[model samples]
Target: MTLKATKTWFLRLLPVVLFFICYYCSQIYFDSYGSSGKSPKTTVSLCDINSSQRKWSSLHLNTSRHPELFLKLEDFFWREHLSNHSLPYGIKGSELLLLKVLAVVTSYSMPGNVESSLDCRTCVVIGNSFTVKNSSLGEIINKYNVVIRLNDAPVRGFEEDVGNKTTLRLFYPESASYNPGKHNDPDTLLVLVPFKQQDLLWLKEILYNEKRVRKGFWKPPPQIWLGRFSQIRVLDPYFLHLTASNLLKIPLNPRRQQKPVHPTTGILAVFVALNYCDVVHLAGFGYPENRNQQQPIHYYGQDTMKSMKNSFHDLNLEARVLKRLEEQGVILHLHS
Candidate 1:
């Protein structure tokens, strides 16, 4: 064969070769790091994760926290999404309808295999912060393999900056609302991050009995507003714990009186992409230490501070983690 023919054949076969290479390396990581019970936590730096510094091997591995998975009521609700806090795992909290709802929803899960793919995928995780307001990342943000938005923020008016596309939108019970005015992409995934059992129950009522849950609304207030175009997935509680323990590596200091908070929606979403995608990008996520601390948290809203002052969610710690990951070249961090 001519040299040109050889080059063409090699290029055509390259994807198949890369897939096996990635698969073989992944098995190694799962064996040595996972089953041996060695520390998954690493003080990674950009120098370490950069492909030029090494190879794609740094990106593949068993960042998967555990081999076994759990998805049952008595098992699931016990896992904490809130800061070291758990929900009362019984039906005694003042409603029976809620109990019936759990019995149904708890049976469904996102499934470990559902998010996996053999091809390379890029993901962009969008946070609700003012840093994104005028950064003009909308066009770039929408082009990723997947785009995830936290809670609910407006995309219509801010499309130039925040991007009008959303692949996934995550909502906790308190933050979960069906925005009547915002654009809802029919294919977007509505993921409910269960802070408590009530959040799960509330989601069920809204999606199923839209009218009875709320009166005379054309669509349920914030429930089933997506209609036929969307679906719901609850974040696994165990996965939430792993990001805190492994990635964020929350300080173990006992002298600190306040308990460490659970991972924020933004961080959890980043970890989700890391598990599934070949590369991940984080936009509008830096702390305002260099700017006014009292500025708005989101570009779309002036009703909040640049960074919240609360123990429920440790915004400061999260900033540091993302910075370290960026330095390590694990993620492309867009803080402007």
Candidate 2:
């Protein structure tokens, strides 16, 4: 081709070259920016893909008759409460043996009850969904007696959308991180959801980093270490299973009930909040599919901009459950 022909071709591809240059530079810039800078270290390619597809047998959901299901059980994490009667599924033999030993090291301690418990109480469960962005719910959210936030959704920067007061923060080993200075509140209780014995093992490591301990089910990166948290509590597996079956209406396998879906942290938080407070409120939950299916998954990270749904947690169905409770005056469904 002649020089004139080559010049014309270069002009046509100029925008394409500039676009690639900008995209590459942005990735480099964002990759090293801040704490929400890089995605939480995970075995999965991404952090949100942390759900395990364990083939659990179906569990019955005939729990509406039991009002006591919401209250704390006796000797919760102290004993391996692995009996199938306590839970629909029995703890596997090896995990049972491990947790039985783990129980020796574990102790249950509740956060000292404040005067607020005796007062007329209202609690709110805040999720990390992007729907709450630009929502002026901060002032109203703070008015509640208790506010529970999930994982590492920061309030310092995004206080307007999510409230500043964090009474409780619920998370698990995979999703939880220890940032020393950010959430330095003695009042905020950090609750751990021990999905398995490995979770307990993992917590032992994070809280009190030991060398040459027996192997646990979960093996996160060696660099995983926790900062100071004022209070820490392990959730009894029975409580989560109870939530999955009863409040969520998940039925036993081979029965005409909702599938025994694993309750997400948000689902568990909703249950926990409802029991403690006279009325509960839920914010930033149930992926807003109608408005924007392509919005960022969490308020903190803008990397994964897409819908939040998975086979493991039926968030939509969970949302429906919350709505039903709202109609029954059990809770208030705070929407964006």
Candidate 3:
């Protein structure tokens, strides 16, 4: 070949080679830092890439295999039967009313399997404990594949400590946020943990925009819930049963004298995450170390530990179970 011809061929191939090199580098970059140059909002992190082989605790293995996370049409009759027997801390709504609400909300039921592009699915349960107020865990909490917040914990101004990314916010009617939009993302699932027949009634009224009921709830629920119906999910009563009976060792049907112990939203949220996540984490849990400590129970509210005396939850027992979970490698606590 002529020298001039050889030079022409080299020049033609140079552009093509450079294009391939740039494309390959770009792919590598996105894989590491994601498309937006940050950890992905809902996928395995680099540190947890190989976490699939890790052995989960017995608590996770026992409950994770169950397919139903939320109440569905199929379980209506069974739930109704259980409710008729005076089951404590379980939904006692009429079968007809319960069926109607389940039909609307269960359409958005969680998938039986954990959905993730990668093997390791990370989750964080953000509690309302005041300990998280200055923990500076916002960036860390936001990195998980799932961020589950409990009750009415506000995330607007506390984003610096409690990341604003919430995949699920679990609450009963009494604890539901008045302004859910300010605390939840556009796609956050509003999971209702019904403690009584009235709770389901309240949800039905809220979803259908029926006349608001000012009675039944210990405290008044939101008069108008602005969230979309598709964003709602009713937690399966089985979780409430499991958390109360197995985890907390509380009786399903307490006698009249026993002030009716039930699982708190924080611990219940952790149980939900265990079923759907590979590595579960907890933030802002634990109560004031002592009765006289004068520490606020919640991050945003001025209410202190004294307020817990009137509550149905036994916070001391919940704290112990959480500690055991941390020790067993089932979950990691984010706050000191």
Candidate 4:
């Protein structure tokens, strides 16, 4: 045969030859080892060391066969430990002993596994709505270590808004008012949740109103508000206080600040509490969970017509997020 013809014949047989070589190598590997050299899974399995000695030998085989397999397995387990949900501290004012017992029971009983420790607990309560007024949520609200409130959240006529308690009050400078009387105390934990870039200017305008300050509406100066909170903390603005899915970005509704005003701020506070707190009991947040529940969904002093419709949406969001976190063993939702 000519050289060209011979080359063609070799090319046609090359694939078949390579296939057999691979097949033979695989057979040799399996027959000599008797098992694949892979690490065991995390699940517990029953086995007798004596009876399964041969099986173990085959499974381990030569270290060279699965070089980093053991290390990789260890890494996997370590990741799980790092991601495991564990709260070291109790909610807040409640006795740590109460949480310790509950933590022990819930860790094993809950659907998802949780680390047994009360040290990781954190609670953030967010709404600035008038809904909390006079409902007597203050004593309960004070139980949380971290309390986050939004713009113009005051405890004056709306006793529930202030809850007679506040750890952190986040608001735009513009929304803060000192007209008739200072709604919040100088000692109150105040945070500035900025909105429009211009809103900061508006905040400054309100806070820095020398006239208002002299009128006794603001006992502490504008510089004083910043000075006081600066000593405490400035939490990241986007640090959601709850479980919000990153799967989809919630679009900002045009009328969000207008009608159907669902309070993302309120929902976020509860969400944060779920991730970090062990036993989360809500207050002032109305009963949209069941229509038959005695309490109305909103705090009393609200513009009943406008706030009622919007408040329901916010309440629903809270209920849904609470349900999901409960399933994850992150929190025990106390729905009253």
**What does each candidate score in C-alpha RMSD?**
12.7, 18.4, 6.6, 26.6
List clash counts for every candidate, in order. 9, 4, 0, 21
Residue 187 Cα positional deviation in candidate 3, in Å, after optimal superposition: 0.6
Lowest-sum lDDT 10-residue window in model 4: 64-73
Q: Give the poorly placed runs of model 1, Cα more than 4 Å off.
A: 1-118, 208-230, 251-257, 290-293
Q: Say which candidate scores most in lDDT.
A: 3
Question: For residues 46-150, what per-residue lDDT tens digits would candidate 2 score against the true structure?
Answer: 111111111001112343222122113244433434445332222333344334433443434444453323434556789887678888788778776668888
Give the alpha carbon lDDT tens digit for every residue of 98-184 in model 4.
Answer: 223223221211111122443432344645433454455554455454455655555666543344545445453344444312555
lDDT tens readout by residue for model 3, 83-196: 443223455545676787977774756532335354667888998888898888898888887889988889889988998898888988888987788888887888888778
How would you order the candidates by TM-score, starting with the best?
3, 2, 1, 4
lDDT of candidate 2? 0.58
TM-score of predicted model 3?
A: 0.79
Q: TM-score for all predictions? A: 0.63, 0.64, 0.79, 0.41
lDDT, candidate 1, residue 167? Answer: 75
Better candidate by TM-score, 2 or 4: 2
**Worst lDDT 10-window in candidate 1:** 40-49
List candidate 3 segments past 4 Å from native. Answer: 1-57, 60-64, 79-93, 111-117
Q: Which digits, one per residue and each the tens of the lDDT, describe model 1 over residues 145-214?
A: 6778887676788888878878777767556555523554665666766655546556666656644344
For model 2, the run of ten residues with the poorest summed lDDT? 49-58
